[model samples]
Target: MRIQEPYTSERVVLRHQGRDRTFVVVTPLELPEQPPALLYFHGSLQNGNVARNFTGRIFDDMVARTGAVLVYPDGVDRHFNDTRLRLLEKTRELDIDDVGFTRAIVDWLADNRGVDTSRIHACGYSNGGQMVMRLLHDAPGLLAGAATFAATMPAADNRVEGLGTVSVPTPFLAMHGTADRIVKYDGGVAGLDAAHSRGVLVSALESARYFATANGLGDPDHETVHGPEGVTVDSWSREGLPTVELWSIDGMGHVVPTPKQLPASIGPGTDSVVASDVLARFFGWA
Candidate 1:
């Protein structure tokens, strides 16, 4: 079965935190017995609408292959109140209960839609990825795994309060380009457009190690590959299953890591691997 292009959301009106919250969901035309769900979040300035097609139709294969329900959530004011405490504008201005919102979305899906609670997973880009990290932090039991691109944990100075101590040992997949200027792979000050700096972001490799430590893993086996040249993968696992993994795409930028053609506005991409495929394999749904 194939997911139709230009997917429309079956709206779920979740009354939480004293407001009517909304999210877009696209389930398979034929829902299997307790299928997994892939809930996606958008970046700093994007909404659910844009995330559905941000990577140039990658979700098409993801949803179809996994046979999982696909969801996109709109962040408050088009931004997820992630770890960064001092972000300018509405992202930091509003008191958003994004963690609660994520939990509520998962509960609604399990109770009403019969989605398998065990296999549920999420992936996001930039700010969206940070939201997923928050999910991994707070609601690990709800999500089996997650993948993040172009974002990572904030530096110690930039972090406000991120689950202090996490509850679940979340399996994570992190991908970032070595050339990402927006959220520098080396960490530290970056910006939203030219107006404001997002403060210090933790380096991508460090972020992976952080998660590895959280998951109780030892030093990761690191290797440099040139599938597309300059990209390296640092992997942590037990037996065969990947507990945590990081993909560093060399010479790439702050964009969805894909080989497909995207507009220049979205930034450069690589053909070394398809993100959806990687996530599917990571989540054990492929």
Candidate 2:
């Protein structure tokens, strides 16, 4: 499919596994910019189209403030788990080529957007968070920093076969809602939850701590942002690699809320904490 580049959005189709996968690039129409660029993966219920179409005003504000470009990619129904009672499985296999895709994206951005490739970062929401964790763990040298909102680490049973070890350790940030019901803040109710309960836990933030410790980042920076609406933003990170930040919304249901947009039913603002801003802060791009 010949994807049209939206107003400011550019299109690049990657041929992976003999299938043409589409990734949308949005940012300044220049290349080799010394500013930071982000490679983002969207959560469940958010397809590439939705991710490409939905432009958060807060995100725009962040870009205006930090000059960071946002690149949103698509994830399949892709199941990363082979345990009993699996959630959703990818239509195809896990897009292992995503690493190559991301590498291409970063290279393309560097060549076309003038972005500082060394400072490139990765982030995702929900399942995107899971994807980011897998990418960082499997291909550590690819990102300088990576963060997630409402995501978890991959299960050992779901490990990609023949994936090599990570040489350059990347700092990471894992964000989640303590009260999340969808991807459960503690993994999941039946799926990841069982894994975590059985010590297969992959809470995004939890993984960061473990990885940081193994990577020799002891006692890293930890902070919490508490608001009146019972929403608490928890962030954790270490120097170098990629920083991981987790925003655990207390008493909030699934899905990060845009205070100024959408309704409260699907879960609205938990207070003044904006998911987009939190994401930006974690990335250090803001």
Candidate 3:
């Protein structure tokens, strides 16, 4: 598939909760009358621009192929106010309404860009992934589908009040590396230090099961597929459609899975599968 450059890109500012919030919108050259939309959330200490480059602009290819508008919303203080109970002092004190911010973005896209609000999907990495979980829990019907990378659902004791109580039946996809030290793949306390530590979490597979159960899918049918590099796929289906799926990349770490080069400090990644391509396929945009 040939990759196309975004036709136009701009930062959009909005007022919510008596504060100004901003997000980046990238439009495809050939846009549909009512295009499906994608909202991507960046990891901790990163902004929309950083995520755009770090992900190798692969999402732009999805935009090119599917005529979908891509959005990247900036988090408050470069960090999202996720569902974790133990949060940074500043983040806890501010208590930013991120879910409200997301709703505002969705509304803005529908009103200004002619986006299909019912088909909007979300994808996030690391800290951003936790935020996605918050969306899935707090704002159940907002997203059609959700994908998370290098993050898991927080353990019951470490979660905020009312989280994990209401579950949306939206299709869910999760990708995690077994070797991730920051958010341990095997589960337990996350982060290497107090500043970075978000909270405790369930195992990666358990995280997948959590969504599957919430989606009312039966036991998963597991399979090991051979790609560029090895990846283990576990899927839960209902009526022949996979409602929940997990990709466990062996020997990988905190970074997103892509053939493109990434900073080594984040830890090992795989060239076996492009993260965006998998997400596009899973979200039925491919």
Name the top TM-score candidate: 3
Score residue 55 of candidate 2 by CA lDDT. 31
RMSD of each: 2.8, 5.5, 2.5
Error of 3 at 13 (Å): 0.7
Give lDDT tens digits, candidate 3, residues 111-143: 999999998899999989988999999998889
Compute each candidate's TM-score over C-alphas. Answer: 0.90, 0.75, 0.94
lDDT of each: 0.78, 0.58, 0.85
lDDT tens digits by residue: candidate 2, 212-277:
654555554667677446655454455553443455667555555455554444443355477667
Clashing pairs in 3: 229-272
| Displacement of the residue 235 alpha carbon in candidate 1, Å | 0.3
Better of 2 and 3 by lDDT: 3
- lDDT pick, better of 1 and 2: 1
Which runs in model 1 stand beyond 4 Å of their true positions?
1-9, 220-230, 240-242, 263-266
* Candidate 2, residue 251: how far the Cα is off, in Å: 1.6
Ranking by TM-score: 3, 1, 2
